[model samples]
Target: MTRTLGIMTEGNDVEALYRRLAWRRQIVLLTGLAALAFSLVLDVATGPAMLPVPAVARSILGLAQDRTVDAIVWSIRLPIAFLALAVGAALGLSGGIMQTILNNPLASSYTLGVSAGAGFGAALVIVLGVAIPLPEAWAIPAMAFLFSGIACAGVYGIGSLRGSSPEMLVLGGIALLFLFQALLALLQFVASPEALQQIVFWLFGSLQKATWPKLWIISAVLAVSLPLLLLDAWRLTALKLGDERARGLGVDVARLRIRSFAIISALTGVAVAFVGTIGFVGLVAPHIARMLVGEDQRGLLPASALFGALLLSLSSIASKTLLPGAVVPIGIVTSLIGVPFFVWLVIRSRRAFW
Candidate 1:
């Protein structure tokens, strides 16, 4: 009888805990939505065409829809901002998933060699100048995504061979990353100077080339991927308890890992295909979201998505405004900022960070 009472009491405690967590997440979600709205306005306002803030707001609200303002806001600034936000969210979600599945905060979409694969693909496209009989623009991004998927699969297959461990997986990814990067270098050596420039610029990353069509494609991918990720949020939570324990809990750990890897690869591939490697948002946004909303995947996922989107939008604006005319690559800006902060975080949170 006493044991029964104790079990009921524990159940009540768990229920209470979940309720409190849900309430907290609701508040965080609301805040994130409000922030995203503000970011949209800011993104529209911050560009070369010095429009009045009031005009930007009025145009956005459809109260003063001048053709010039519409062109500037919709055609130019809005798409670029939205693309940055989309790419940022995708990378962040990808990183969060990778980190959860691996139980390692350092694991990211880039960590597993997807970026290298995309780079190689883009390199091939640039070096060969193969038109693909499509628009030059479409061919570049399409090829990048294709190569990125191939790279991710190759690394995963090699790492998951019989008796492979996490260490082996990490080693394999690192090996592939360096190997592909070296191959790109060799390709550059044999290519003409113009091809070298194209390859270099693609690697550097940019929103300079953002287009309405590309934005829609990324949005469609995100729409599909984000829902699937949310649906598997429970499995992701189970995964944090270790694969063996998760398996004991009736979760198919291997299948979950593979699904996560594929989704992550697709996300990273699409981003790299369009914007190249805009690094660090994926790694940093999840950590920040976790700090705010706790580690529960249900809340953590959406919060990370919102925060990542806003962070990248702000970074894009800064990249352009920080030096006017000479737009610094978003990847350069992120790496410059993220690397030091990450190192410091590692030092400070020696226990939790690793």
Candidate 2:
């Protein structure tokens, strides 16, 4: 009778602990959503041609009394804000997925060379005058998308040759990074001064390039890919138990990796193609989310996405406000902001999140 009472008490304790964790996760998610909302408003309202918060809201709701204000709000700031949110969410989601599958906290789109490949493809179009049948604006991003896919395929193929070991995939990514960097340098070496300037600026990752069409493209991709990821959340969680253990549970480790790689490449490619290479969001956001919510992918994934959108939206606001009348490249801003946080994250935690 005493043993039965003790068992009941222990089970209650376990249930209480789980309830506490669930409450904490909910709080984190809600906080992230609130931050994202605030950042979006600040980004749209605090630009060079600043608009009042109420005015911005009115314009967005189609009740603006001024045409110019409406145009600025609708045509420029709104799209840029939305793009930042979408791009950040995509990067965060991809980062979370990559870290889980690769069993590497440091794994991200930029580290895996997807950004370098996209950069090379954009450079080819911008510097070497490579043309496709697509419209002028679509050409560069299309090539970037294509090259990013090619790079992921190359990395996967090389890794597969060695049984698709995580270390092999990391090594293959590093190799591709250097190879693409070399190719970009060669293109820059031969580029005309004007073309060189364009190439360099594109690499700087600006949201000034945001358009409704590009935002739609990114949104469509995220809409498709995010659901697939959420559905695979359990499998990804299984992978955290180590590849051999996961495979023993019928996870099909190799197939999961391949599918995830393709999805991540697509997400990363679309993001880099439109916005240039915004680094560190993917690398840092997941860690932040993991630290906040533990390793449960169901919560971690959405929390990561929310944190990412919040970070980039804040970055967008900073880029505009840092200078009195001029905006800086967002990539520079993100690195400056994210690197310090990343260092602190490493220092603050001694426990492995996995």
Candidate 3:
């Protein structure tokens, strides 16, 4: 009887500990979301015109009547600001999944060749023109989206030949990365100077081209993909414990990995399709999210998305402010910001995040 009471007491204590941890994780997620919202407002307010934050806030809320301010807010800043959020969320979510499924801290579309594939596809359209009857504006993004999927499929296909192990998939990704990069280089070598300039600018990544249509497309993809990922949150969290353990927990490891890759491709392909290739947000944001919320895919995934959006929104502001007048390419700003931070993250951690 005494032993029974002791066991019950211990169980209660464990339950309380879990409850506290869950509450703390919730707070972390809420804080990240709040930070992301503030950053979005700041991103919208920042630019050459530099609308007052209050004015931008009013404009956003439909309370402002000043035509000039409304036009600037609605027509230019809002789309860019919102697109930054969507793209960043997509990248971060993809990165988190990649890292989880592959058990690699550095796993992301950029590292796994998906971004390079999209770049190659865009370059193909730029250099060779769309073989299909696409509107001139649609050609590049369509091809980019297509090839990103192709890269995902290619990696999976190659990995399948080697039993689709995580190591095989990563090796396949490395090969795909080199293949697409070489193809891109070949296109650049033969590209006319004007075409080459356009390609380079696209590669540099910019939010200047953000439009309502583009924002909607990215938002739509995010809307679709996020729910699918969240549905498998438990399965994904299990995946973090390695394939043998996940399978021991009744997960079909191969199927889950394949499904994850499909979603990752959609998230990544669409993101880079529009924005070119913005690196590090995917790579760093998930790590940040992991630090805040640990590895529960439910909290971690949303946190990763929020932090990703926050990072990109902050980067957008810096891109405008860093150069005084000329807005730098956001990709360059992200790289500059990401590199040192990434180095710090690598050094500061007491042990492996993966």
On TM-score, the leading prediction is 3
My TM-score estimates for the predictions, one after another, are: 0.93, 0.95, 0.98
lDDT (tens digit, per residue) of candidate 2 on 1-354: 999999999999999999999999999998888878777877889888889988887887789998988889888899999999999998888888888888888888888888899999999998766869987578999999999999999889888889998888888888998999999999999999998998899998999989999999999999999888888888889899988988988898998999999998899899999999889999999998999898888898998888888889988998998989999999999999999988888888854244
lDDT of 3: 0.91
How many clashes in each structure? 0, 0, 0
Clashes of 3: 0
How many clashing residue pairs are found in candidate 1?
0
* CA lDDT of every candidate: 0.81, 0.89, 0.91
Question: Which prediction has the highest lDDT against the true structure?
Answer: 3
On the 0 to 100 scale, the lDDT of residue 52 in model 2 is 90
Question: What is the C-alpha lDDT profile of model 1 across 231-255, one tens digit per residue?
Answer: 9998899888887888898988778
Which stretches of candidate 2 lie above 4 Å from their native place? 1-7, 62-67, 351-354
- Give lDDT tens digits, candidate 3, residues 1-354: 999999999999999988887998989988887888789889999989888898888899999979899999999899999999999999999998998888888889998899999999999999988696888678899999999999999989998997888898899999999999999999999999999999999999998989999999999989998899999999999988888999999999999998999999999998999999999999999999888778889888888888888899999999999988899999999999999999999899843355
Displacement of residue 201 (Cα, Å) in model 1 is 1.2
